[model samples]
Target: MQGLKAVLPLLIFVFCVRAKKMRWCTVSDPEHKKCAELAKALVAVLPPAAVAAFARLSCIRASSTTDCIEKIRANRADIVTLDAGEIYSAVKQFGLVVVAKEIYSDGGCILSVAVVRNSSVDIRSLQGHRSCHSGARWTAGWSLPLGFLLSRNYLSWSKEQLLSQDVSTFFSGSCIPGAAAMAPALCTLCQGQKSYIRQKNYHCETSHSEPFYNSQGALRCLRSGTGDVAFVDHLALESIEGSDRDQFRLLCTDGTQAPISHYRTCNLGRGPGAGMVTRANFRKTARKFLTTAQTLFGPRGRERQRFQLFNSSSFGENDLLFKDVTDKLFVLPDDMDVSQVLGLDYVALLKGLGHEGSSLEDSVVRWCCISYAEQKKCEQWALSIKSDPLVCVRAVSMRECIEKIKRDEVDAVSLDATHTFIAGRCGLVPVVTEYYEKERKCVPAEGSTHLETDVLPSVVAVAVAKRSSRSIFIGNLGGRRSCHGHMYSPAGWLLPYRHTLSLEHNSSSPCDPDQVYNSVFWKGCLPGSQGNLCKVCMGGTGEAATKRCADNHNERYYGNMGALRCLVGDPSGKSFGDVAFLEQHNLQANILSLSSTGWADGWTASEFELLCGDGRRAPLSEWESCNLGIVPPNTVMTRPVLTARVYDFLMKSQETLAANPNTEFKLFESQQYGESDLLFKDATQCFVHTSHMTARSILGGEFYSHIESVFNCTHSDILEFCNQDICSIFE
Candidate 1:
């Protein structure tokens, strides 16, 4: 947080505005410097109908694709064009969002093709064959073909060796500018032999002086017999189609061959066609900009200008601002995000090619957490579920964890109900939920009637007294000894308190319950409290006493189970509560039984019971009659724009973790034994599957809003603050 201070405050303010004019970033390659001219041309050509909403464009120059991605993230620029491979990086590394894609002139997306001379003998083996590549890591030359082979395990390379070594082994020699720094073998067959060997280190570089570079130059190498085969895109072959059409043959992956123009049927794979991207938050802006650009230059648009919207040759590079093959600014369907645009199998392909480790990461699910304590336990949990282990990544907070998810730094997280809201608001969606088999009833979270269901009931908040006790009931419970879980919890504090305030008590119309609870309860143990409230709480003596037990181990009684334990009291056998307010689950979860963590604090389920209406007592399972309120369960949430990888990963985890017979690795059980629930709830047996529901539906509209209202209240609104009596006592 402190590090943000180094950034200028004015720039932050400027970055936040949803301005009318957009900054369009263009790659500034010195070798192909027409990005400036192309930017002017695009701005000049926008359709007149879009002038009011997006009247102008401010062009920003970026030295490379990586630089352009950075500009988009910092908000110094708004939009840029990228290939599928670069788009993958931009989305994963820079949080860039995709809005529109470049449709080729022929109405087909770009395709990657491998070309060899027609007269070449049936070339079964590429080993020792000289080759020419468009460039390193470009969708056509590298990502598609190499990604295809690597993902299928056709090639093997060690992390210790450069990727160039893998390339060098597959092909005897090559000319690829992208490999100049890393792989010297690729440039071995080049014809250029400049005098200044030191100055022109990569002799086969794509300048006019060098014979080969880019898609065109790589094909030129094939035409001139400089290399036996050329790895390039459909556009590269199209460049020489008229005069030199018979000179090249397309190499298909299945050990077959086709003519140069047979790219549609005989090709490596669909190349990641060029796309325009912007910062994720600017989805609306990017959409407008793309629609306007396409309206001005789409196939349907009036071609008022000499230079076309998708013309890369206008800028001297065949695929400069956009691909040379691009004929229209196509709008992607709303369902197709950048990842989907790349295609699922292709994403796996790219990941395989780029993997630094020898083995595939496809089997592992990287889980996100906010602290070392969680990660420590998660590591052990990972060991238990060895089938598909969890690898942990730590962030500063929940915000950072979601931010990391956006950047592909981590996979998933188990979120609380409210935090799930924040994650959804950040574009994550619910993948799965902690499904307690117990059927719970629920009212609409906001503005509607409750959902209808048969078997599964909602979890109700309840007020419990011993079944043997004959006098206690909901109506005359004032001045009773109370036991409650932590503050702000729905069951323990909010719902029960809401119910208490609604009762027709013999008192003045109460606007505030903080004053009422302290006066009503004879003595209460609400953990994480001080003064008289702590007098009832059982925090052990010594250093733990100094700490406020607001969260977990610091408080002797926390969660629903903790409040129940408080009612039965501790090892000293001192009974504490006349009534315990908590989730209805506590009644059924046998407190007498030994948990994986061991015995339940020297207490038994038989010692306590549920207090019902009219001062009656029922067994724990019959909670439909004696409950305070019910709510939906906790959920597993992810970004709304989820890729198939993440969705499948989570669903697989849900199935694998819950299928264990011996309960050796329980996904719902507490990771920590003695303290409050750590990774998951202590009460949950197994999560039953449910359709993805929003955080609002999960928390219930009324309860969600109630929490919001209480949270929004000022500290001065509390009676404790008014009287200097301490706020913790109210819980």
Candidate 2:
């Protein structure tokens, strides 16, 4: 018995040693030796608890995807972290599973343009100027900024265009491989070297070390005049501040609305950002671990920690890694018909929600037919039951529609909210509303009754041109003279004094109609005149005129009249864009200006500011006001009823307006001769024809066509057969 006990203790020791060696072997590889060293360095800097947790967890070390795959094949590791771009490449090459992801909020890159402060180089004026970038791989560092410049025609790739024309280009390898590297880099760079000198700060410095070196080196090179401009990330600049702080200035930056980088842009398949991946054999296990780990290390978990080592600030609490990955994963089907049947219009829906359009139509059609049928049905029902009544309503013409509404034809009309508000006054009402279900109440429309849904309250308001004479009088008194004079007046006030005969002995008596009328009605009958006109002209002209008019008439008229000259002044002072001018003065103001300008100056700017009560001028942004309040234009992009083509047409109209030099376009509306009903009939026919096919069926056909364009299919086509079935079912 004593001998057996001794043997058991020896066996237990051997097992423990084997387990320790196995754990080390799983992560230690010749190719990943550097990564292992990096991991160890990271561990040394981590808090005691984090270090303990990391030690307990398995480590995955690999140089390339192939090496990672090989280790996984031997059951070495389960989880792998990589840059999103690299992962895409690796997955495409090796068919690996991506179980988790870490998306950067602003395109996973940090691009900055370094220029000498007070240099003649305006960041925008640097178009075609010699620029050195840190290569395309550094997405935030270079690619995104370059792409933005290219899109804006600020940078050109043509050698001929660049030659002798202030264009030069260079790329230096700077920035780290992933966002994990960038986070620490950003902290270190902003906080400075002094903050990172301590033992606790070493982890951040090491994590950001690569970016620091690249940024520091690049800035030094730029300062030395090796390049005209340097495009890099924040870390690079931060690293070299002590040496070249005074010499360099950030000319432009991504994710800021400053003058230097007013509009930053991004694209797919480039830049440094971490992503999640799992071993093919251990995907399920990896996913489970990630899910569990996220719960333990998520926002709630960090909230419980007295002092968080990773996320000291709340910024990382909602980082893409934890939020996006934790949400549901939707895998689109390979078979177009299947996707359609399942209602997967993933791309189209995104586009509808204001994303740039891709080939989302098929997906949208499928989703419309299948997945979103109930929602669509509800929307259609609500629209059908709307109380306001949807009809083919029009004003005199397109321009008149804008103008007459400004003139106050009816209370309000339902059109594209963007268009109406873009062209209408600020208080125009929106017909449809939108809201999140959890946040608000939704009232469904009953048949033939327009029910207001509280789910989405109209962000826009409806306004009518002042109607009451009192209101108009007050409005006019308040300096809206043009509106008052054009819309209001009393008739027959001067008729009685038309033929007043005045008898003067010396000269032929000239009868003054206005004077006679004012005298009789306004002046008290003092009775001094010759012949029949004597009785009519009872009092003096000034006193009679004053009493004859309405109590507030003079006040209203003079007050409004005073504003006419101001209104006629140049409307283009504010530099407020197109829509502003349209909404403020309404269509009439612009029309009058057009007519007056044509008569006087021959041109009027689209948007202009007019002087108001104070010395300060309020911007007359009619176009902006109209656009902001309009519904169709604002909501059309998201509406299912408006087809992609229709939405495109509307957007193109706005673009055309913006691009036109005069900021004005003549819209001619006319009926087809002898075919007034033709338009309606044709539209109805098309609607009926399209309605016969289910969304899925339409998608199936579209997908088949797309596939046929790409690859010749010899096998019996599944999409074509499914299309018929879908059509029949929908019909």
RMSD (Cα, Å) for all candidates, in order, is 16.5, 26.2
TM-score, structure 1 vs. true: 0.45
Q: Which runs in model 1 stand beyond 4 Å of their true positions?
A: 1-363, 366-380, 392-411, 415-419, 438-457, 466-482, 501-546, 553-555, 573-578, 586-590, 594-606, 611-621, 640-663, 668-678, 681-692, 697-731
Encode model 1's per-residue lDDT on 92-209: one tens digit a residue: 7666777777766554356788888855533346667888877666778777766545422344444356556887888777887546556778778766545554434336543333
- Cα lDDT tens digits for candidate 2, 1-731: 35434433433343333322112212123223433432454344334434443445544644333345445546675555443333443454455566654433343333344544446655555643444433222333343454444333344433223211212232221222222232322222221133343322322121222223223334543555645555554434434435446555555423212223221331211233334555455554455444434333444432224322123123311111222222222221222232132111221222222223123332221111101212233233224331222223333222233333332332222222222322322212222222213343222246622223312222221111211122321112222211111111111111111222122211121133223333332121111112321121112123112221121111111112212212332243221111111122223343343444332243234333432221223333433342223211111111222233232232343234345535222111101111111111111111111111222232234432432332232222222332232111211
Reference-based lDDT, each prediction: 0.59, 0.29
Cα-based lDDT at residue 180, candidate 2: 25
Off by over 4 Å in 2: 1-34, 37-122, 125-137, 156-227, 253-731
Best by TM-score: 1
